[model samples]
Target: MEISARNSIKGTVKKIVHGSVNTEIILEVASGVELVSIITKSSAENLGLVEGKQAYAVIKSSDVMLAVE
Candidate 1:
């Protein structure tokens, strides 16, 4: 897929959490680092997203948010 996001990281899907409306895909990148992507169930199914499958996490700098506790 052609994503406009420049900060793209390739990783494997490590886990999938299906919610009532949306699904959360967890991807494991380098050592102990994980990236999360949220998508609709239909979209996830359409993309055939599954654990252990190769996928790309497209992240844009503008989309990132910072928080402190």
Candidate 2:
């Protein structure tokens, strides 16, 4: 994967929540932080996302708007 952003984190797919419309993919990164991404059901099916699969969570600092305590 191309590392265009400094906030990019690589991890494995730990769990997947396939909703009726959209699906949520959970990834476990090296720092023990979990990254959650929402994608379309069709995209999830096409990508064949499952647990224990390696994936990259590409994140940009600008995309992250807010964080809570």
How close is every model to the real structure, measured as TM-score? 0.82, 0.75
Give residue 21's error in model 1 in angstroms. Answer: 1.5
Root-mean-square deviation of every model: 1.8, 2.4
Tens digit per residue, CA lDDT, model 2, 1-69:
557677777799999998999999999996678989999999988988899998888777665477789
| lDDT comparing candidate 2 with the true structure | 0.87
lDDT of 2 at 21: 93
Q: Can you give the lDDT of residue 2 in candidate 1? A: 82
Top-lDDT candidate index: 1
Per-residue C-alpha lDDT of model 1 across residues 21-54, encoded as one tens digit per residue = 8999999997799998899999999999999999
Off by over 4 Å in 2: 3-6, 61-63, 66-69
Best by TM-score: 1
